[model samples]
Target: MGSDGSSSGVVREPLDYVGVTNRTSSGFSLIWDSPEEKYKNFVVTSKDVGKDEALKPKSTNKDSEDDSEKEFDNKEEEAKYEQTNKSESENPRSKDENRVPESVSTPDPQNKSGTGSKPVTGSITSFKKVLPGSSRFFQFEDLPPQTEYTVTLLGKGPGLLSRLHKLVISTGPEPPKDLVFSEVTENSLTVSWTKPKSPISGFKVTYTSIKDGEPVSVSIDRGDSTLGLSQLSPGSSYEVSVVSILGLDESDPITDFFMTLPDPPTDLRAVNVTDTKALLLWRPALAAVDKYAIVYGSGTDSELRVTVSANAAEQQLSGLQGSTTYTVTISSQLGSNESSEASTSFTTTSGSGGDGDGFGDLQSKDVTPRTARLSWKPPTKPAGSYRLTYQTEGQEVKEVVVDGSVTELNLSRLHPSSRYTVQLQAESGGRNTAPLSTHFTTDCSQELLNGILKSGEVDIFPQGRSGPPVMVYCDMETDGGGWTVFQRRKDGSVDFFRGWKEYIKGFGSLSGEFWLGLDNLYNLTSMTKMTLRVDLRDQDEATFAKYSTFELVKRNYKLIVGGYSGTA
Candidate 1:
């Protein structure tokens, strides 16, 4: 009621009884009966205290002795004191029923009342002086929660001795702050918060799914500020609340909302594939989505991407390659969140004409050291002709043209054990189809001889040969094995006489009576020791001439032969 203490000569008497009227997390209120004896004013003061200090026995020092004498000095105190006249009543009340209420106190530095003047330090102290006619109720506000406070009442006047009454009480706990959600996934999320600056026994966490409005609650230790929740539905919204607890009291709830990640599209597949386009289909995601992202790529190529609205169940991809395998992935998106991807693969059908037609199933067969047979299915539409081009690693491309009716062609003069890429295109009315490609490696003659068992016309690589393999007639069933025939004359269908140039350069076929080139013979014989055999064949009888250790000099027609043993 009053801020300053009363003037000197007024008589003062202690209040009769002081009791708590109301209390909250932040503050409390107190009420006291007016004293019977005359008094100018009553001073109320309070300071925060630790639990241990609040429970300690009251000190018997001079100030405390005086406080005891004035404790509950009025009529209500007299009745309660007489009822329970036990020695333990001398102690301050510690239970909740008798806990002290808080009050704002104003300092009265000018008061010259009769009392000791020792200063109170390191504590929150205030004085509220009530006049004779003012209300006896007082409230203290803006106090820390879950904290103990010591409050004292003193009747002060000029000639009257000052009396002190003390009480201890605690405020309710404060709520936690700064609630946050982290590490959120499709079915789980982590919640954390800042602890309130007050003593608390623990925390109570409650969450309810917005979809079903079913609430779940859990108790958490005071030391932990984070909790992980799982076993929830994907793409769901949840309301979460946190409350701090102290003994039987709890703070107001702090609440927020959170969401789980959306589900991804499922059962992705490709259909209606064409040489230049493909259609992608999938089952819709269970959760609502904003869009869908599709990504695709072929072997070692940069990936391509496209997007479709969430309502769409299929997406068409264009500008794809024919007869090529590709991998594709699809994912659902909601707001800024994207779900995990669902993936599939497919190959486009061959084109009908221009750029991606014909030759989709190009293949190679009968591959030898120096020759291979190339074949393919005819184009969907007829064409004037087909052009074929081929090349080995680090070599110039070679090309050949064939009639539209030809579906297969024989390739010749290829190197042994070499990799080659062949591309074929169908041409019609000056326009050409997309080139279809295939790869093959030529076999060495030695491999064919060893793997085939029987040999006729074959290709061979002489010792130290590099440019290309040689075409030859191998006599595998002779007296011994593995013979290269440079000359054979079993029929008169071929001419024997020929110019020097004709002899120098090969003018023969391995399957007929012909002569192998002198240049080739010289190269083969010069590389290593060789043996030659000449067979004379008539109607039913045949005679043979044989020579071991034979050689042919280069650039000249010189011949060397020795060790003949066959009858001629």
Candidate 2:
């Protein structure tokens, strides 16, 4: 090595790079960088210096190298020399600073030996060799383990004196044994090993994933024989190798394999919840896992688990009790080991609105030829509203929305003797109650009487009027049952019996509602038309003068009127 701007000469012109490389216990490799210009020859010397020789003060008498050997022979002076050498290296004189300049500097004397022991400068073997400049490596074989060695290099050039290069290096400790898993967690693991019998600097751990690529490595202090490995893959197997490092070298790698449990599932949540069923959704573990287990139950119920395939993102849980709260947990598994569980809880909604047996005691009353009245008792659980729907046979249904309190409704315009079906239901909370249905038929007596009167023979005033007949309203119940009319000829005969039915049928347009002149009743004296007011409830026969529906035929017909009428 050359001194910094102090000494103008060069030692082998200073190597491009020079140190120990590929070192191990029992042996180490010494390498020196080749120079730009090749040398004809080179020499490597390894000296086995005793501890006493290395610790003794250097010979201040430049005249005698033999004085250095003599100082090591005296035990008491050797101890005093050891202390003085330490002080001189710490506060070196200007003369010593000028020797190597900044190219050489001592390590901290406090850490002169790594474990506070006196550091030696040699191994048991001494090697000296003169080899060609082509040589790049010198392997010092079968050296003592954990011993320090001082190596010197010299290169011979043309017309140049070979210069000396010095380096000190130590061999590594022995390899560790019986490395194994001491503790494990989801994302971390602890590895333990037997401490090497020989001293060591630290432990170097290199781990490889059983599932993927290149091994990862780390270094830890020697005091921690059991070291924890973190940032490890969950649910994965790995092979880890532990090596002991001494000084700047490492021992052989000792390997052990281990597996870590998978991490818990993430982003747990629930969706599509119902009274009796729910769907649970979650994100699968990022790492590889074999399967998943889903466990769910209410606080008061026994929990149950369902196994699902890996990569599944959701599960449907059914048969849940209505209006209940439940807790659910999701866990991922790799073989028999399962990761810590991820959990979520939710409450179900109340059961959906239902239809019950409402609208009871349904009936139809006050039946008529064309109308009916319906009534019913309110249901036990009255709803917000009611729907009353009714229909004749083969007709579209008609419905009325009513308050729940309404129990009676009038259904009108029904055909005589035709059957109608009525349905009733309660409505509450946007739901419909069970329907109560019943059947009803209108009274047929009115139609039967109407037909009888219509079938009678027709009689006309012989003016050939083809237009529709004049109209009149009939109270079939009162008029037809009593069956009377103010029908009589001037000659007084029962022949007006035919007039009761026939003339009444011609009064279809209500033309018989006006007054009748009894002063000259039935006078056929140049009248264009005539009307009759009739009421037959007086219990009269065919000769009755005031009947509800009465009729006749004659020439020059004049209008006549009787009972149930006002002034003309």
Candidate 3:
């Protein structure tokens, strides 16, 4: 409606609902229809037309003036009514503003839907939302570096209302260039990245020991650019991904993996031992290790077993028997880092048994005494007569020749009841008798009588002496076999010598001393002056080579003469 109460040919058409336009005037007034009606007015100065007049606030003009003003207003009112009647009251300034400027080029404001304007140039009302109350905006801060994440903005109301200004601002720092893990310590790791180009709201890092799985999150405060991951397992590896947030936008995720420092070998010890069991022990491998191997055996034969971290130095082994020799070698990874190894071994106890000549021969029987009547046979050997060589226990061997073919031989005149050991010999030609031996105690008793037979006729002899008495018998049986009996007297008794004369080869002389030969027979009367040369061959054989001169004292009637035996 015009001021004159007529339709203006400048038709008051409705503005495009998406844009604000007014055909009435450059300035307008909003009237409140409340009980206290009031008006809030706004004015558009020449500054609204691209002139800088903002310094002065302009107001609408309203005045009752002179006759010229009244006439001008009347005519202006007529013109307005004529335009309304013609239905041509369009906003003239709107067309000029819509025309593209010749100096500046721009894309069509129409959107994919051919909407009124593109979000890029859209007014404050064009803000759109993706999620409700789930978004935040970043002002001046740069996006986190080497990080990945997602962001969402929320709209105030439901429906197709473009309520979110979600500028999916790639504004997120360029997914932190060169996201890296460094300065790793025993229990912590430092992650750093390049500076971002745009502002960021927050940052998050996902990390875990496992691969291809959901990781744990470490959030960064608004102003922090670096992350220090703590409480990390020592000697462990972790895969990390970063998520950066900028306003309501997120950057592409970046992933990286790193391992913690390695630990030293543990659980070192010596295990079981036998005569040959290998020793063993083990420890878990650290993250810095490439593999593991063990060298174990008797101090010899060292074996190397290759193993990975998962199968680290376990208690299993090859070529290692229970209670056998072993050497352990635990090795770590190689690089700027140095590796290490250790070794040990032990032996098992053996069963109780052994082999050898453990004992000497032992005599099981006691020998007879007084008369060394010993019955001994070779305990083990080629049999022959026993020489019955004996010596007192702590005395030099006193060789005695006992004559007899029987295993039992009587040795008369042995010290009464003295102990003696007889070594039986199966002596052949010249060999010594290595005889098994026997020992015995002796029972020696005084002889009943003693007698001596000299080279002379007996003048008197004791006869019919019936009493307990001791006697001595001496005879040169080789020359003359004679018997003389006498009663032993404690007081130099006078006794008679009665000769049996039958053994005396009358009128003959004899030579040499009557002694036992090496044959052990009381046969050969060895001449003291003669050389009885005997040649000893191998232990088994011997030969008598020479028999030299010899002499013997003999009695011939009333004269004592020397008997000579020529050497042959």
Candidate 3 TM-score, C-alpha based: 0.26
Deviation from native of the Cα of residue 125 in model 3, angstroms? 23
For lDDT, candidate 2 versus 3, the one ahead is: 2
TM-score of every candidate relative to the true structure: 0.41, 0.35, 0.26
Q: How would you encode candidate 2's per-residue C-alpha lDDT over 1-568 as one tens digit per residue?
A: 3422112232224445455655666666666676645665555656554452654334466574222122122334323323433454467573432232122222223442111111123344455555555656566555666666666665555533233565555565688888879668777988888988887789998988775545788889988788888866677789999989875667867887888988777545554555577777665674567899999998645898899998688898899865566788999899888898987765454455523332355556656556777777664566789888887656788989998878889888666545566667677778865555555555322232223343212221221122222112333343344121223223332233344435533221222332222221332111211224333332453322332222222322323232344322
Worst 10 residues of 1 by lDDT: 114-123
TM-score of 2: 0.35
lDDT of each: 0.66, 0.56, 0.35
Off by over 4 Å in 2: 1-171, 210-215, 299-301, 350-568
Which candidate has the top score in lDDT?
1
Candidate 3 error regions (>4 Å)? 1-170, 183-188, 197-203, 208-215, 220-226, 232-238, 243-252, 258-266, 273-277, 283-291, 295-568
lDDT of 1 by residue, 177-196 (tens): 99999999877899999998
Steric overlap count per candidate: 7, 16, 54
Please say which candidate is ahead in lDDT: 1 or 3.
1
Better of 1 and 2 by TM-score: 1
Note the residue pairs that clash in candidate 1.
8-158, 16-74, 105-126, 105-127, 105-128, 106-127, 355-434
Candidate 1: list runs displaced more than 4 Å.
Answer: 1-45, 50-124, 127-142, 151-167, 174-178, 194-200, 210-212, 251-254, 299-301, 350-568
